[model samples]
Target chain A: MVKVVFTDHAGSEQSVEVATGVSIMEAAVSNGISGIDADCGGSCSCATCHVYVDKAWLGKLDAMNPDEDAMLGLSTDRQDNSRLSCQIRLRDELDGIAVTTPEFQF
Target chain B: MSDSIVNEEIDRRPESKWSMVGKDPYSMPLEKIDLAHPGIWQENEFLPFLKRLREEAPVHYCAESATGPYWSVTKYKDIMEVDTSPHIYSSEPTIGIVDAYEQFTIPSFISMDPPKHDEQRRVVQGVVAPTNLKALEGLIRQRAQTILDGLPIGEEFDWVERVSIELTTQMLATLFDFPFEDRHKLTYWSDVATAIPGGGIIDNNEQRWAAMEDCLATFTRLWNERINAEPGNDLISMLAHGEATKNMPPMEYLGNILLLIVGGNDTTRNSITGGVLALNQFPEEYDKLRSDHSLIPNMVSEIIRWQTPLAYMRRTAKVDTVLNGQQIKKGEKVIMWYASGNQDDEVIENPERMIVDRPNARQHLSFGFGLHRCMGNRLAEMQLRIVWEEIMQRFERIEVVGEPERIYSSFVKGYAKMNVVLHPKKAA
Candidate 1:
């Protein structure tokens, strides 16, 4: 299981362990994470599944792609660490990843 | 109507990154886009991609010129979180997908924050509100029935053009209190503004740009004329005196008016076409629906879920944040794949299959979520529902004589020209 931390739109943080093969959006929704809304099932279409990658862990994760970049342009509160949770896949390297949720998304 | 391109000719398997025509974001392969032909999603690489994302990376990453590098969020529950929150992610920069921020101006309320967005939306909200729509239901039904009367049984026609565009455009004209004769212009302007996906159907960047600018100037002229004229019941009049809009300069208002044409056009057109196609695709569901019209609402939601008119919308990051285990920097863009979200296995059971009675169908992110949900959603639904109802009563079946064509752009998923053969109950 990968330990993931999420911060809600209200700036609340919750950490949980997600399975390695599962998407972060699934982990959050199944474990009751309040902020990550992956409205589109990882199609690189909708920007609802938004989250901020912890500053320290940015390098560990895979780089962002063009489709994600285009969709991310639609969000309400985008940040430096802001990433769509659906885009990031779970793995051992990201096992202890800590992320923050923005205060708002659209 | 069947789109023209034959699916059998393409690779039957899901398009792998390596197998894809172009691996990198910078070099866009136009060949991969079957502009003249529609792709069969049921058997295409797109559906499997959604399934894989659901089981694998609910939130996936994508790199492109618009946001450089960004994440794509998939899965139902996660999308809800984004939809519900508006303060964090934003759409103030642009609305059309695929295009960079420089290509388009700041969108209207469709991409704005609460206070400012709600202020502008209020003008039309009263006019297009569900309650107001209910008041216009009889009129809409009458008009719809009249249009249905014109369909030729077993003869081919472009449903996308005849039914979807004309009906919705007429309705939009009503909301704008526009002159009935000028309704076609609204559709034209919308098509131009929405050409952000590879610069529209013609693929001519310069021509589309010049045309759109000209159309925009005309809209500005008209908005000014209407606003300065009598206080009519249309959106233009409302905006002229509206609390949120009265103070704004003419350019912003012009931008918003142009925004309206796009906001109204692409979405409603795709919905109707999508609905009819969905019903045709599932003959059993169509039979069930035709036999029992009560399933129209659920079917409408399912159509919205299935079609997802505005394919993908974007949002920018405000600060440093982490998604899943990925590191994200400040001011980065994140794209949400609503199409994939709708098919998330974790959220909707057998999401790939369109179950008419799917309880969570409303959970789809087609109209978007949170602060920027499509303001014209009610109007869209009303029009679609009415269209399907009329179809159910008027036609025997909507046959697919030609292979349907898909939109060329990555942002919007729809048919530009779908040639369909309609078999009606009787000749009009």
Candidate 2:
């Protein structure tokens, strides 16, 4: 199992043990973590699952794909560390990855 | 009579030749196929046509049809491109392919661009907020239990009328605080609101107006009553007292009312019916459900994706836009076929079959996306989740006994009649 921490807009953090190969967005949803609507079901569309990866762990995952990047660019709150959680698969190397969800996903 | 008028309109229109291709969809080139014709949907021949469009021509154009020329975005990625970029692809004027009759188009927030759309949407958004949804859960579960418990076992009955329509209409009545005895009128108005002339629900435009006038009159009375009362939680009261919506014009008020009614009624209702049909179609999935009830919520999303209650939403090009290398001219109708998008193999693996536990189930475009996404989506999902939970505890199977009589229109992809019989589990 890989552990990923999600800090919601309210500053509450939830660390969930997700099975390897599951996307972080799926982890947040199946764990019932709030603030990740994941409305488009983690497709590279619908930026509802946008999250800011912790600076230290950002380079651990593969580079963001163009589709995910375009969707993130649509968000007014995007940051350098911004990533769509749906695009990041949970792996053994990314056990301690952390990301913060934006206040609004619309 | 309505058929003759359609024939007359077709004969008079100089553009009718292009539309003739739609008459024989099977022989027409895949790229030229028009799924907008109500006949294609009514005859239940739309599935293969849509499949072909998704494969051969992801962004095909139909230059002629009952609703005129429009672009069909069939692939998941292409549909998302149009749906997300509201600025280029405007929902203004209307969302359906058919133009609203002259001086009759209602301007609801769903059809408005930002500033106005955001402001008006904020007014009633509270009705489906998380806090409100939490409060409504108990009531929805209780209602679902009552509705399910009332169904007769071992007897074929129309599930569309008894289960799907009844539960959704009940929810709508509570939302508006509408008269319970007259709650069926909500369903009636919803059907009439989206009905196509000679499409089996209404005969002509005149009858359509007559039905809508009845809807307007009925809701106007409720509006008047609620406008003066203390602010309440019901949808009518929300609009009546909302700062942005308190003084809407007659047509705008009617438009918003129809938006809420149809938005609330159809999606969830069809999913309820579709869920049973899908389970029956794939019994292993039903076995999966029976073995693990925890999959209910995910399965709910899967059902909505599989059914895609609303097939397509039309948007007009505010500016010329090139989507998937296809030039969409300004003012051209660009339709995002959610039904096709939901089945796009590129996005969803093995897109053909129902897998209740599909991991990315909620990724489907059934509730739409961006600012105009279905406002009552959470409410819709909550209702479905509760009903199915109650169903799992009660019955071994809700067998689909006969063919589902589908609705006539291409817009609302749903059932008109679905005969079902409940197979009750013997009391432990």
Best by lDDT: 2
Sequence-dependent TM-score of model 1? 0.70
Name the DockQ score for candidate 1.
0.05
**RMSD (Å) per prediction:** 13.0, 5.9
Off by over 4 Å in 2: A1-35, A41-47, A50-106, B1-26, B102-104
Model 1, span B82-124: residue lDDT tens: 5554556666565543333223453466666656776676665
TM-score for each predicted model, relative to the true structure: 0.70, 0.83
Highest DockQ: which candidate?
2
Chain A vs. true chain A, TM-score per candidate? 0.90, 0.96
Q: What is the interface RMSD of each candidate, in Å?
A: 8.9, 5.8
How many clashes would you count in candidate 2? 2
Cα deviation of B65 in candidate 1 (Å)? 6.0
Please report how far candidate 2 places residue B376 from its true position, in Å.
1.1
Docking class of 1: incorrect
Looking at model 2 chain A, report the run of 10 residues with the lowest lDDT sum: A69-78
lDDT of 2 at B40: 60
